[model samples]
Target: MRESKALQVLKGRHLRLEEPLLLSTVSGVASTKPALIRYFDQKISPIGIITTKSFQVTPNPGNREPVICETTKGNFGNSVGLRNPGMDQALAELRALRQEWKFRCLLNVSLSANSVEDFIMLVEVFSEVADILELNFSCPHAAEGYGASIGCSSEISSDYVRKIKEATKKSEVPLFVKLTPNVEDIGQVAKAVVDAGADGLVAINTVGPIVHEDPVSHTPILQNTIGGKGGCSGRWVHGKAVSCIKEIRMAVGDDVPLIGMGGVSTGEEAAEMVLCGADAVGIGSAFGTVSQKDWEPYLNSVLAEAEARLKPGKEYLGPKSETYLAEDRQMAYRKHTVTKIAYYGKDTIILTLDGSLPCKAGEFAFLWLPGIGEKPFSVAHNDPLTFVVKKRGPFTEALWLLSLGSDLYVRGIYGAQLENERTDKALLVAGGTGVAVLPALAQQLKEQGTEMTILVGTSESVAGKALLEDRLSGFGSFTCVADDGKNGRVLDLLNGLSLGPDQACYLVGPEIFMAIAAKKLILQGMEEEKIYLSMERMTLCGIGMCGECVCGDRLTCQWGSFMRYDYLKEHAPSMVGL
Candidate 1:
């Protein structure tokens, strides 16, 4: 399976290295930094190295406190307060990596300065030694006059990128501006950089100096009592990253190529980034998957697998499922029937299609709204595709505008199956639109006349209650809660609906609600796998092409739109956007 054109572009550009490969640095081992070099060398490829920070002649100590920690929220936060070994030492490290590596590395030299002269001087020093000079306009953790201090204010970031572009006038060395995701609208900042003559954009430099605590102590883990949360990484950060890439791609069009990074762990992850409009994939956490010895082999295997998965000629990333559909008439339209359609309000509608008899109980169908776009919606009914949608945005709006006889586009009978139906009576919990899939499962149980109970949580919206009433008419038993007292509170409903230990549970709603519910249930001694839930992330590529819809290592569009509560709890912190 050859790579789709979107992926080929990313893998095509070859960065030239200096010398033979060497594993001289283990300090950066946790990041698989060396394997990046080895990946380029063995693969005979050319990619850039985003070098660590370096200041001007004057040295500055970054945040001098606890930089990293694990939080109860299941995420890592660090206040690596701009700790650098000074310019001379930093230059030496870059020189060493340059001298021994096979492919020529594009040095994204990061530097912070208070004045124009300071930036000029640093660029002067790295001009000869470095490939691309990245002006550090977006480090959220820096002191006054540096990092986001300069980048956040468009005027400052623009002036700095312009100055550096002029200083490197003699050389065409591309100057990239590492933008901060902390901004209200990152696209506006990206536009500023482009106008300032930045060669390209390196979006989102982490969410913040997030903090993890000692579970027992229940106190802050890091010494830096205050942390500027940087870019959210791991699985949670995927959608945010994609959103940034999409905004930049939309704003810039094709004038400059994008180097997308953040939360990418596999080749498929890399492929997804490309489809959302990235030229190359910057992998950092992927190194965590393999050991030092297995780095080369791991990179090789993932690269091969990713290449095989992509389509032949699509500008976007992933396997290009839509593109494939365009080519083969036989593959274009799949057959499905609308089992049920419930209109909650003028804008909100729930449609349960039929055709999922071939799939497992919890599997989902990829709902494509033609020109509108695509998203992975869990099967509300399952015979076909039962979706509860509100006229929220473009896609959902388009769905609302759709009539019953209108043609609907859909793909993928994809997702994990409920391998063993829990003979243990089941408990189903839903929130808002989360109840879309509950009806189908309920219908199945009702037909079989099995023991099942459903609990739905919603806000004080009549539409929500209306939809719930329509869907739960035939279930074993049903309860509805409206936060505003119109119905009842979700918590109230749950408290009222009791079940014994021999019951499996499924939860689908807002993340916080599910988290709270799962945590409470676990304390009640329920098995982790007994509870399941739905998570909605940015699902750019339905076939798991774009890693946009990720929850830890799994693609919500592929492995799940439905996942075990235990799995989610384990990866929740890292799975931020859920």
Candidate 2:
């Protein structure tokens, strides 16, 4: 019968909220414009505040893929390399969100600069539009001389915060410094920032630049090949967050507000943060469970539970401590025994595993061979976790020679999947091994009762033609164009087809080929939004955290593997070679 006490005043500003919960930066899910629009439109509950993904002055291409890996339940290790669309584009998107945002919003800004001027400039610019400014001083994955590089040094952290406060003096924007948990003493860092005029603090950014490896491959699972260290977040980092918040709260002595965030996934965790001296708790990663529609109910359940436990004048009890075992921190790469391997087409082979892995169409996994390393491949089939492999590099070449009963490590179900828009008809275009992702899409379309047509192109036709036909059997209408055709290019086949107003097209192949086909479809009067293409990039992390698979402003691992031509044209034209 009473309103939740989650709404509290910070720095003389009151955050009107339905509940106390705040969605932390879940990167691709919480930081993107499209994702935010959906969240606001759906009115997801406990929306005390929303924070954008950390952005810097310049566009960061990030690192190569295999950027993120789940070490255990609710634990993720990621080295995203601070990928963002730079200041100009970031400002434009922020302005757009300002116009539409009904809830309080904080812009999370990071700086990877040689001098403090860039940091000041960012603060000055963002202070004008954002309700609150979060200075990301603790991004462990940032390039050298940035993020944690700055935060770890008390003098540098103080100087940066001092300059930022001075820069925003005119705007009087509240500055919240986000600190790193990897430091020797986070409390000391917190004190330095607070002394330098930080209005608040976000305790414990991701912990550790941890590494994970594939046991079979005896190599790092991340595409960076070395398993470069990445920050750890989720359930595993919850204790670290609590300890950091406790220390900061002790250091700041209840004056500076501390926002505790790390691996918070439930209402109990939220309450635990409050008890640990957090003025407010930020929740992320947990929302990965359901769609935007379900967020309100999910948050309500979380808040209700928190409300019941966090009564007035509750005493602070220390968090329960636990030890993490080797298995707890390790990557979950399942060892699948290869049951079958057969040549599909020239240079192409289909590998069938002894057991199945749950996956969706368009999702991919890392295939690991000990001493040979691991690489990502689109799932050719789900039931038995099949992969259509091509001998493109050392990994694939090694995979080609793998005999029956050979052990391989497969981990994933990453990237966005092809969704049915309920269109009357759908056209699928595949070039080379891009055909591997098609069977799953065709099957989904068929189940949805959407008439489907597939046009596949290969450099050379061998048993591969028959192999493709067998995969698509009973799924859709199929056609093929090979180099042996009158024209050697896949684009030549698109000239004869017509896309109607009610039709949609999905393309996957070499970048140039897809770009040409997309251009052709658009020229034929197809709405750019109706045309989709799969982008191939060196994906380090299948999640958006690793900036390796960025296509212009979008992360191919998160925003797309399948993306709309119109959206790309407007936001990321470079992605489509426009």
Candidate 3:
């Protein structure tokens, strides 16, 4: 077991690091796979599993694009109307995991219904197959009158919990009710769930359905048009998640297990969740943002750093700014490229500028748009440090107006480090603008004589093919997919490629595309350790302090933007962005 300063904070039921456990109730698919199991054992020990919602009885496709999005904050927004494979499939997956995994698995079954009976039926069906069942009365967007709509109401929350309590009378596994952060006072809701017999609580799911524009299309990014938009998360969401956890912890007292999530991407962040009242932490966006190959290392690094910081002699690296830059040679800039613009398609213009340092494939740099503010963008390449940007916000809009050679202020190689050292077989999955960083990664992989395959998914034909011809040309074996049948969906291309077990799959782009890919990989029986994916989120403060990026137990900006696909497949399935 790893040592942690947080060990002290973990007392009573809160202290459980038998292995590195994560309250991974956020993943949608790939819930129970060997790869996920391996990741938990290798990266985070003493693991727990949380499967995505399988409706009480039927299978359903959740939300559509703009199911998740990349805002200036990091990545947020998902309108996935509670899609799941239903309880039958969920139970089968659970039973399989219980029989196979060496560790004790906690299946956080997220369920929703229009009525308490719907919730009860769900409980009865899968209650015996898993360790824990989470009542997801708090989903921001659900089929009419379901999910958060009911969770927000104390009466509804109470009745639903009570019904499930009665239904699970023979089940020893505890029941955790996962709540939303949208309420003005979530304490009341927490009390209701507890009084109704919830054994534990997973405090604060994503806070909103905030929407953004497509700049060029002037249309909503999501296909659902008007559902709960995926909320922004990262350092920004920390205070809120903590506040909610603290309040709920206080309300329920210490007897009830309280798991903290949201904006937690590092061990320190997870420790904070513990301190704030979470017995365990849940990670979502962090795992979703990066490729699977990068996932375990990212979690291990976060936990390792957190453990180090908690030690007696360790020095805390507060924010990675003026302090670290001075002591670390890696942060210093080798050369400065003042405002330089490169045309990316017809609608997007990538601006490269000067700042703290150059960027690597998995690392991100910050762009300060003066009046519009600063934003973090993945370093597309280091040979020529670049940012693939869309003309969305005021700063970016103003940036578009600038001619080539215009001076642009840049800063940071902030966020988590990339596993540039890995020699694993690589599978790159990119969606829309996500293809930006692949060029550099592909280039390096090719240079190293590593075989690489790039799969790009998009909804448009022109955009899909353009990414392939213009940017991905230099990379080995590039394939593009368009949902509208523009060229071919990346999924089909992947089928043709015949991925092997040794290959590490990496994904970026829209959340759903990544989710589908991750799930597909898992179903294909790929090791989760070999699957990789990336997620975009609302990142602020660059460092881990801000809580805006927490998805279950991870923060995308600080802890990851790169991760193993299996890590995501096991936890936070819905938020995977597939």
Number of backbone-clashing residue pairs for each candidate, in the order shown: 44, 15, 86
lDDT tens string, model 1, 1-578? 23222223323231211121111111111311222333344442323343444345565554432333333222334454555466776666557766765434444566667677788777877665565566667665556677778878778888887887777676645666777777788888888879888767776566653544434334443443244243334446667887888888788766564677766555566656666766656654333222333444554444443454454542323333122111211112354545566776455677766555454555665565433444556666544556777666666777776656665656556555543345448777777677776765666555554688777776655654564576585666676766665432575455534568778777777777677777667766778877776665544324332233556555554455567766766655533233
Q: How accurate is candidate 1 locally (lDDT)?
A: 0.56
**RMSD in Å for all candidates:** 17.2, 7.0, 11.4
Alpha-carbon local distance difference test for all models: 0.56, 0.68, 0.60
Best by TM-score: 2
Tell me which of candidates 2 and 3 scores higher on lDDT: 2
Tens-digit lDDT track of model 3 for 470-563: 6676666766656674432766665535666567777787677777777777777766776666666655434432234445455565556776
Sorted by TM-score, highest first, which candidate order results? 2, 3, 1
- Could you tell me the lDDT of residue 552 within candidate 1? 50
- Candidate 3's TM-score: 0.55
Ranking by lDDT: 2, 3, 1
TM-score winner between 1 and 3, please give it.
3
Give candidate 2 misplaced runs (Cα > 4 Å): 1-9, 12-29, 32-43, 99-104, 110-114, 213-227, 288-293, 312-331, 336-363, 368-376, 382-408, 414-429, 441-453, 459-464, 473-477, 483-578
